[model samples]
Target chain A: MVLASGSMALATRTERTPSLIGSVWRSTVGKKAVMAVTGVIMLAYLVAHMLGNLKVFFGAGEFNHYGAWIRTIGEPFLHHKWFLWIARVVLGSAVVLHGVAAFQLSRRDLAARPAKYAHARRRASYATRTMRWGGVILALFIVWHILDLTTLTVNPNAEEGRPYENLVASFDRPPVTALYIVAMLALGLHIRHGFWSAAQTLGANSPRRDRLFKVLANALALLLTCGFIAVPVGVMTGVVS
Target chain B: MNLTLRIWRQRTADAAGAMTSYEVSGISEDMSFLEMLDHLNEELILAGDEPVAFDHDCREGICGACGMVINGQAHGPERTTTCQLHMRHFADGDTVDVEPWRAAAFPVVKDLVVDRSAFDRVIGSGGYVSVPTGSAPEAHATPVPKPVADLAFEHAECIGCGACVAACPNGSAMLFTSAKVVHLNALPQGAPERESRVLGMVGAMDAEGFGGCTNTGECATACPKGIPLQSIATMNREFLRASLRGGRGA
Candidate 1:
């Protein structure tokens, strides 16, 4: 009997399959924990990144100093090598972790029940279902901004001018500014739901604290969304330049 | 008063159904929605037709037995259950389009009736104190705080009506499930079984074929009892904590 049991266990092991993995990947609890943890990390990153980016309003010296300061969080080894290497590893890994979790979650979500676009009933929430679309738009905006501001010098790039002028120039176009505004609106909506949800995912909200957390999440989403939107609108309308 | 009701009639699970219009006249403006439904049944019986099969008990709105989407809104436009919805909110010649709650999990059993036993299964999975029926202690044995008691009462107000479920596009019952979870877990007595209760109920909700919540917030908006959506989040957090800590049956 012991030999039979041992052989059965061995047989199962020999034919090893990831059916357990598959099930876990598809479960509400499993998928949600991934979302909550990744979401919390990303949220923290956003706060710090947004605060850092706001340095431009303080002037160029401050702006570049902030950028350089940010750049140095990576390059503590300063031999021109190890300092930024460790930071690069950490930042890159975090992004990868967040991206992988988000991608897997969205895919499982899509696969859990197939929605045929053929009948395409528009019954879903404006905020709940648009995260995918918003993610796309935000990605595009980031690429454009990076290319224009950092990498490939656009025609509007002024070498000696403040970062402020460059931002104004970027949003001077109605189309781009409008796009940014829309993206901010979407981001705000996404984050408004995401914060409390993330906390819930992490098991941080109690009955006593749940309402308070949601209010705080809404306030933060609103403030950041409004902050991001204001810059583009200000630039486009010549309120700032 | 006269009312026009366009009800959904599906013959079988796979059968095609449509909005069949019925005209009801001489209704009292003070009649409860179920009472009005009774009048319709009475008229149908007179005409020798099959009466609409809808669930109702204790037409006073506490049973959560009565549910139908009245005019695209769950439990009508009122912030009360269907049994509590009065005709006073309507005018003399108002036309109301009534339909059963639409969700894959809640299949139509007939006209205006849904198989809400999915909820029962979720409840049965372990939405209980687990104490033996006769083992209940004195009411004041624990001396629960008033605020906690009040919140528990609010959650306990959930008649398990599935109004929140009806309003959710995903057809999620997070609000209902969460309310039950919060109701029991809020009390000192129910805390011993909190972990198992949350884990079992949520699993049962999924197993019974409810959709996942994406936090549209419509469920709260449509809830007759005004069961807040945050309770869903609280359940969410609870479920997460339990799962992380190696809870009952994963």
Candidate 2:
């Protein structure tokens, strides 16, 4: 009986650790924490990814070389196939987590009626509303991006091209370049709210640093957006072709 | 100062909402914003009309119960809660736009009163110390740095007012939730459950139906306690560390 009971106890202990997640979800601000933490991860990925993408301005050879370099960064942990798969997994999880949390929050905000008012105020920004729409845009861009370059696939409806010379062919068309620019712009909008907001969610607010964050956030958003737009615009304007 | 008021009126939640304008004449710059609201209610009552519904308690600004969008800004332009906001912040003949805190999580319970129970649910999930009954511990059982204590106190200043949520672009309550996390978890007493607390609070925040923080820094501006937006950053770091550790079986 003692032996049997000990085995049961061990089984219960295994069940205990997972409850930590449940506990946090039940916490006062656990839900927001999940979004904030996950957001920071995605933000990091975005910065790194955008920097790598800038290779497009270097011409087909340099751009493709950069793509090859990206396909190699995971070296020890990721081969070409493995890296793509891993990125898909990690990035996909982040997207799912962020979406689920956002939807839930929206519903709650809508339901908190009756005896409301008390704190009615409107102090949000344009980036705030645009975030919801931006997410949708970016999702489509990602899928299209993979097919157009990574898989060397083209859309049946808009097959005005190929992704030749390190994916330079991908930018040869005005419409394609325009789409890339638009997607990057949307990404910029998403990041503007993301960078500083994530920090605040983590509880790092200080008066001086907060101001710094705002400027940095704005600067980063502008840089990435303008930079991304500049590249595609250059390609479309025959500056890169 | 005379003010033009754009108040949102609805007979009930089931009723469609509308923006109604009223001319509130006679100005007292010394009156608290809510007091001015009270005068408006009195006038409405005399006319046999339903007084506007807005949330306010303790009239002193700490409760965070009073929130209204005045002139398109949350809690008016004084960087103070509506209760503490006085008429002096206004000029004569100013048109004041009054509306309930707009958010999905903060539903309109009546006119101005929103159902902030989502916050309570977030709290109930784990915004507190799971203390067991015991004899009081020594006050100085643990010596804490003054800075840390001060920060904790500053964060604790949050009275669960929905102002930040209302002020957020994404309608996020990250400021409020992060404040709660930073307020209690800063102390040594809060250490044992630090990971659990942060993790729990963040998860509860998500589950309660609040938007994610896309930090426009507006929530901090609207916070009655003036909770800085960095608290959200701190909580994010904590949650990440805790999750990584937990994934590693730490």
**Lowest summed lDDT window (length 10), candidate 2 chain B:** B241-250
lDDT per residue, candidate 2, B185-233, as tens digits? 7987777777777666767666666665555678887776778767777
What lDDT tens digits, residue by residue, belong to model 1 across residues A78-144? Answer: 6444654665466556556555666655554444333221112345456667765765665576567
lDDT (tens digit, per residue) of candidate 2 on A72-178: 66778766657767877888898788778766655554453223443344435777667767878988888898787666568433332323252456677768877
Q: Identify the candidate with maximal DockQ.
A: 2
Candidate 2: lDDT of A135?
Answer: 77
lDDT of each: 0.73, 0.73
Evaluate every candidate with DockQ and list the scores: 0.22, 0.28
Clashes of each: 6, 79
lDDT of 1 at B79: 90
lDDT (C-alpha) at residue B67 in model 2: 83
RMSD (Cα, Å) of candidate 1?
5.6
The DockQ-derived docking category for candidate 1 is: incorrect
